[model samples]
Target chain A: MRSVALQKGLAIAVPALVFGFLVAAQWATLAAPGSRDVGIRYIDPLTASLGRLQDEQTSLKAQLADVRAKLDQLQRAGAAQNGTVRDLSAQLDDLKRRAGLTDASGEGVVVTLDATRAAADLTQDRLPCFAPDLTDIVNAAWRGGARAVAIDGERIVASSSVYCVGGTIVVNGSIVSAPFTVTAVGPTSSILAVVDDPSQLSDLKRRRDQQVVDLRIASVPAVTLPAYGGPVVVRSATPQ
Target chain B: MRSRVGGAAVAAVALLLGVLVVSQFRSRDVYSRSLEQETPESLTTLIADLNDRNRQLREEIFDLQLRVDRAQSQVSGGQGTLEESQRQLEQLEVFSAQSRVTGPGISIRVDGPFDDHALSDLVNELRNAGAEAIAVNDARVGPRSWFAAGANGDLVVDGTGVRGPWTVRSIGASDVLYVAMTRTGGIVGQFQLIYQRTRFTVTRENALDLPPLAAQ
Candidate 1:
C-alpha cells in the first residue's frame, strides 16, 4: 500500500513541478527591464556617433573663441601702431559684417515656423517644413532688402549650405530643428511687405493652410543674430 | 503516506523557485544587453569632447589653407591677391562668429509654457526678416547651434539649458521684426488663438550687444 501511494504522489508531483516551472519562466521573462514591460528602446551606434560629433563641436567652439579673442587683441595693438593699420582695421570690420562673421543687431523681423504637434508626431515626409523651404524663405528675405539673414542663430552667407537629413535641417553644418526662427535684419516695411506678399514665402503659407506647419511672424523693436560658427575655407577660389 | 505527499509538494515548490531564478537571470542578461548601452551622463561628456576635437581639426585645416594661400600669393608677387586673401581672412573671422557684434534689433520674449519647436519657428521667422545675428538667452546662436528639450523637460540649446522667459535677441530692424511678429493672423496671433495662457512679446531695442559664440 505504501509503495502504491508513493508512486501515485510522484506521478502528480512531476507534472506539477513542470507546470510551475513553465509559469515561473514566463513570468521571469516578462518582468525583466528590457522586456515588453519596459518601453525604453536601445540606441544604435550611428546616433551615438552623431552625439559624439556634436559634443566635439561645442568644445572646439569654445577654443575657437579663445583664439579669436587673442587675434582681436593683436589686431587692436596693430591698429594703435599706424594710421594705415587703423584704416585697414575699419575695413576688416566691414568685411566681417559682409562675411556673416560678425553679430549685428538692427531693424528686422522674426518668423517662426514649427510643425503642429500632430504633424511632428507623424512621419518625416508629412512634416510641413524642409531644408529647401527655409532656403526659399532666405531668398525671400533677401528680396525684401534684408541686410542679413540667419536661421536659428546661424548666419547664412554665400557659402552657407542647407540640407535636410532624417527630418532635421542642417544649416552651415549645424542641425536646426523646428520651430525654425528666421531672422532678417533689413528695412522693416520691405520685410513686412515681402512677408505679407502672397507670392513670397508661398510654400510656407500653403503648408500652413494645409495644416502641415504652424508659422508665426512678428516684428520686434530690435533683434540680434549670432555669427556663423562653421569653418570658412576657400581652398581653390582666386580673386576675380 | 502523508510524508510522501508533503515531500512531493516541497519538491514542486523548490523546482518552481529554481526555474524562476535561472529564467530571471537569463532574461535579464538578454534584455539588458538590448537596452540603451550608454548612460546619459557618459554620452553628454563624450559628445562635448568630440565636438571640441572636430572644431579644433577644422580650425587647423583652415589655418593651413590660409597659410598656403598667403605663401602662394607672395610667390606669385601679386600684391592684389595678397590683399584679397587678407580681406577674405578678416571676413571669415566675422562670418565665423569669432568677433562680437552689437546693433539695434528686436527681442522676442517667449514666456513659456513653450517648446523647442516654438523657439525654432521664431528663429526661422527672424532669419526670414533679415536678422544679422541672434542669441537665445545669451548663448550665441550659430551654425552648430541646436535646440532640444532636456531630460528634465527644459529647453536646451547646444547642450545648455535655457531658462524662461526665453529671450531671443536678433540684431535687425526692431520695427520690422516687431510688426512681423505681432501682425494679425501671424505667429503670435496664431499662438494666441490656440494657447491663450502663454505670453509672446516682441520688444524693439535701440542697441543690442551679442557676444561671440564662445569666450572660453
Candidate 2:
C-alpha cells in the first residue's frame, strides 16, 4: 500500500513540474523582444482612428469656413475693420531663407520625386511617416533656402512627414500621388543648386535622371499656394 | 521524533529562503540592467543607430527586389551596392522635417513647475485651440506619447522631458490659441485660478508647420 502511494506521488509531481516548466517557458517566449504577443507591433493609427477623425475634421472645417465666409461678407459690408489674418510672407521668407529657398511666381517650374520601389515593402522608418529620399530634398531645399514650400497643396509645415505608403507621397493629411512636386517660393538658382549640388553628389538628380523619383525646379513669380485649413496637429518628441 | 523532524524541515525552509533572498539582491535583473539603458542619450542614440541600420537594411531590400527582375544584379556580385545605397540614403535622412514653411505663427512653449498632469492639461488646451504639432525637445507629442513629470522635476511631454522654456510650436492663428490657452475656463487660467501662480514662456510665431494633424 505504501509503495502504491509513493508511486502515485511521483507520477503526479513529475508531470505537474514538467507542465509548470513548459508554461513558464512559453510565457517567457511570448514576452521576449520582437515577441509575437509583445503588443509592440505597430497598428496603423490612420485606419484605426482616421476615418472617424476625418469626419470630425470635415464638419469642423465646414463650420469654420462658414463662419469665416460670413465674417468676410460682413466686413465687406463695412461692419468692422478687416480681421483677416495677414499673409505669412515675412515669416515664410525667414523660414525660406533658413531652408535655403527663394520665392517665385508666374509660370515657374515644379519638381517632383517618386519612390522607385513598390509600396508593399516600404515601411515606416524610426521617425514614422518619413522616407529617406523625401527628407533629403526637403532638407536640401530648406538648406538651399526655399521660400513658400508645399507638398501637393498642403503647405509643408514643421514636423511635416514626407512619407511613403504603398508608393505614394503621404504629405500633410492627403495622399500626394507620385511625381511628388515640392513647390518652393524661392529663387530658381538656389532650387537648382539644391537639386544639383556636386558635393551632395547631385543625388536628387541621380534619381531624377534615372527617372526614379527626382527633383524638378522652375521659377515663377505667381505660383499660388492654396491656403491650409483644418485642425493643426502638433507633434513633438516620441514618448519614451 | 516527529517534532524533531518538523523543526529540522522548517529550519531548512528558512535557510533556503535566506539563500534565495541573498541571491536576488546579488543578481542583476531586468530593472538593474535596464538602468544602463535608462540614460537619455543611451536611448536616443539607440533609436538613432537603429534608424540608420534600419534604413540600410531597407535600401538593401529595395535593391534586392529590383534585382529579382534580372538574372544577376550587382548586389550579390560583390558590387558593394549596400554602401552605395547608404551614400544615397544618408544625405536625406539628417534633415528630419521641423519647419518647412515661411510663416507667422506662435511658439507657445508650455512647460513649467507643474507636474505632468498640469503640463498635459496645458498642452491639450493649446491643441483644442487649433494648435498644430508640439515637439518637446526631441520627443514628438502625438497620441502615442504620454506627458509626465520625470524623477527630475522636468516635465516630460513625450519620451523627451522638458523644463522652463519648453518650446511649443503651432501653425495656426497664434493669438486665438494663446487667448484660449490662457482664457478663463481654459487650461492655463484654470490652473492659475486654482493654484494662483504659474509661470511659463509663451510666444506667437506667424508661421509654424501644422503637419498633417499627426496622421489623424
Candidate 3:
C-alpha cells in the first residue's frame, strides 16, 4: 500500500513539474518585447505620437496669440499718441468690414441649398449641386445689395474661394456639404427679391425643376454673419 | 522518514508551480496591453487628421501675421478707442474660441470606432445641450472645425485625428450636457446604435481646462 501511494505521488509531482516549466517558458516569451501574442499589445504608438504632436502645436499656437495680442496693444498705444495714425485706424475699420475681417449683423435672407433626397436615391451622371450654384447665389445676393454674406456661418470675403472637391464644397479652406445655408446680412426684402428673381434663380430653378437640388429662401429679422476665418492671401495688390 | 521527505519535495514543487503560473498570467496581461495593429481605416484617419491640422495651422499663422501687420501700421486720436475695441474683440474671440481659451468644464469619454459625421453631430448635440465650449482630446472645435475622411480614410476634426476612446470636454451646464449626451436618441445613444461595443461616459468637474485652437 505504501509503495502504491509513492507511485501515485511521483506521477502527480512529475507532471506538475513539467507544467510549471512550460508555464515559465511561456511567461518569458510573453514578457519579451515585440511578442506575437495579440492580447499583450499596449496603446498604439501612432495615436500617442499624434497626440503629443497636437499638444505641442496647441502650446505653440497659444504662445503666438499672446505675442500678437501684446504687439497689438503696443501698436494701439502708439496710435493713441499720433494724429495721422488715428485716421488710418478709422479707415482700417472700414477696410476690415469690406474685407469680411469683422462680424456683421442685420436683417437679411437665409437661403438653404440642399441636394435633393431623390437625387441621392437615384444614380445619375451629373451631381445635383455644384459650387457654381453657391457662387451664383452669392453673386445674386450681392447684386441685390447684400452688405455681408455667409455660407454655413462662414463669412464670405473678397479672397474667399468657393470650389468643389469631390462633391464637397470648399469654402475658405473648409469643406462645406449639402444643405448649405447661405445667410446674407442686408435689406431682407431686396435679398429675398434677388433670390426670387427669375434671371438670378434660372440655374437654381433649373436644378430644382430637374429634381437635382432643393432650395429654401426665407427672410429673417436678424442674422449675424461670422467674421471670415481665412488668411488675407493678397500681400501686394494695394487698392489698385 | 521517507514519506516525510517525499511530502516536503511535493510541497516545494507545488509552490514553484503556483509561482510560475502566476508569472505567466501577469506577463500575458502585460503583453496584451502593450501593442496593437491598427486597421488600415484607422491609420488613414490618423494621417488625414494630421494633414488637415497642418493646413489649418498654416492658414491661422498667415492670418495672425496679417493682423500683426495691421496692428503695426496703426499710428493716431482713435488709436486708444481702436485698441479698446480690439481688446474687447480679442476677448470675445477668445471666448468664442477664435483664439485659445481655458476654463472649467465637463469631460466625456468615448471609446471604439466612430464615423466622422457622427462625431461632428455629437459636437452639435453638445452645443444644443448647452455646452458653451467644447474640445476633443484637446482639439478645439471652432466654427470652421469639420469632420472629414482623411487621405487614408480616417475621421478627423478640423485637422486633428480622432481615435477611440475620445475625450470630449465642454464648458457649460455639466448636468445638461451629460443628460443631453446620454439621453435616449441623443449623441451617446446615436453612437451606440452605430457601435454597440463602444463605451460612453461623462464626468463633471468644477474645473476642466481646454487649450485654444493650436493647443487643443
Candidate 4:
C-alpha cells in the first residue's frame, strides 16, 4: 500500500512540478528587461508623432523670435531718424503697453489655484470646471484694477480666452494644467479687495471651502507679466 | 511517511503557482492602467493641437517678417514711418477697445433669461475663435473687461448695466465666428441645454460697428 501511495504521489508531484516550472519561466520572461516593449509597441507611433510636433514647435518659436527681433530693430531705427516717427513710436508703445503686447511690472497680486489631495480623487469630473473659476479670478483681478495679467506665464491679452477643452484649460490657444498661477500687475490693495471678497468669486470660494482646490493670494512688491506672444494682427476687424 | 511527503510537494507547487498568477496579473494591471493615462486618441489629439499651434506660430513669424520689411523700407525711404505707426496705433487702439471698429462678423441676440456667466462664456468663445472686437449691448469689452451679475440679476459689463434682449456683436471673420457660436457643444448649444427658455439667434453680418468702451 505504501508503495502504491508513493507511486500516486509521484504522478501528481511530477506534473505539478513541471507545470509550476513552466509558469515560473513564463513569469520571468515577462518580468525580464525589454518585455515592456510589448505594450509600448502600440504607443510608439503616437510617441514619434508627438516628438515631431514638438520639434516643429521649437523651430517655429525660433523663427518667431528672429522676426520679432528684426521688427524691433527697425522700429528703433525709425524712431531715431525722425521726430514724427519718435512721437508715433511713443504713442505706439503706450498703446502696445495697454494692449498687453509689452511686458509689465509693478506692485500687484499673485493668485494660485492648485488641486488638493481630495481634488485628485474628483479631478476627472470636477476639475474641468476650473476654467470658469480661473476666469472669475482673472475677472476679479481686472475689476480690482489689474493692468496686466498672466496665467501660468501666458500673458492674458485682449483676445485671450480661458476655457476648457477636453478636461484641459486653454489660455491664448495654449493648453495649461493645474496648478494654475495667475500673476497680475497693478495695485495690490485693489486686486486683493476684489479677489479676496467671496462675493466676486463665489464658485471658487465654495470649491476652496470644500477642499476641492487650494486657492492662495499673495501680494508682491514687484511682479512682471510677459508680453502677449500670440498672433496680434487684426485680420478681419477694421478700425472705424 | 510517503503520503506526507507527497502532500508536501503538492502544497509547495500550489504556492508557486499562486504566486506566479498573482505576479502576472499585477503586471498586467499596471500596464493597462498606464495605457489608460495616455490612450492613442488622446495622443492624436495632442499632436493635432501642437500642429495647430505651430501653424499659428508660423503665421505670426510671417506677419512679423512682413512688418520688419515694411519698417526697414520705411526707415530707408523716410516717408512711411508716420503712416505705418498710425496704422499700427489704430490696430492697437481697436484691440484695446480705444477706437471704434467695423467689420464683417457675427451677431448673437439672446431674447430670453440669461445670466452674466452665459454672456461671459459667449464672449470667451468669440475671443477663442479669433474675434478681434466684441461688444454686448452698448458696452465694449476691453482687455480688462469683466462680466458680473448686477443687482436684481441684471447683466453688468465692467460696471455698466445692460438689459436683454441682449445683442452681442463681434468683429471677425463672419464664417469663423458663426461656426464657433453655433457648432455642436459650443456656447450656444451649452446655453440651450442649461437655459431652456433662452433663444439664441446668431446671424452673420456683412458690416457691424462696435464703439469704443465708455470712459471709466
Give each prediction's DockQ, rounded to 2 decimals: 0.06, 0.02, 0.05, 0.36
DockQ of candidate 1? 0.06
The 10-residue segment of model 2 chain B with minimum total lDDT is B28-37
Best candidate (score: TM-score): 4
TM-score of 2: 0.33
Off by more than 4 A, model 1: A1-44, A121-129, B1-57, B60-216
lDDT of 2 at B48: 41
lDDT of 2: 0.43
Q: Which is superior by lDDT, 2 or 3?
A: 3
On the 0 to 100 scale, the lDDT of residue A23 in model 2 is: 53
Q: What DockQ was computed for model 3? A: 0.05
**lDDT digits (tens) for residues A90-187 of candidate 3:** 65555466557677998999888776544543422233336667766776676577888888876765335465433445565454555788888988
Q: For candidate 1, lDDT tens digit of each residue in A6-84?
A: 7776677676667767776676545433233233233455456766676666666655655554455555555555455
DockQ rank, highest first? 4, 1, 3, 2
Superposed model 2: Cα runs more than 4 Å off: A1-64, A72-109, A116-130, A165-168, A200-203, A207-215, A233-240, B1-216
User: Weakest 10 consecutive residues, lDDT, candidate 2 chain A?
Assistant: A119-128
Error of 1 at A99 (Å): 1.2
Candidate 2 reaches a DockQ of 0.02
TM-score to native of every candidate shown: 0.48, 0.33, 0.43, 0.79
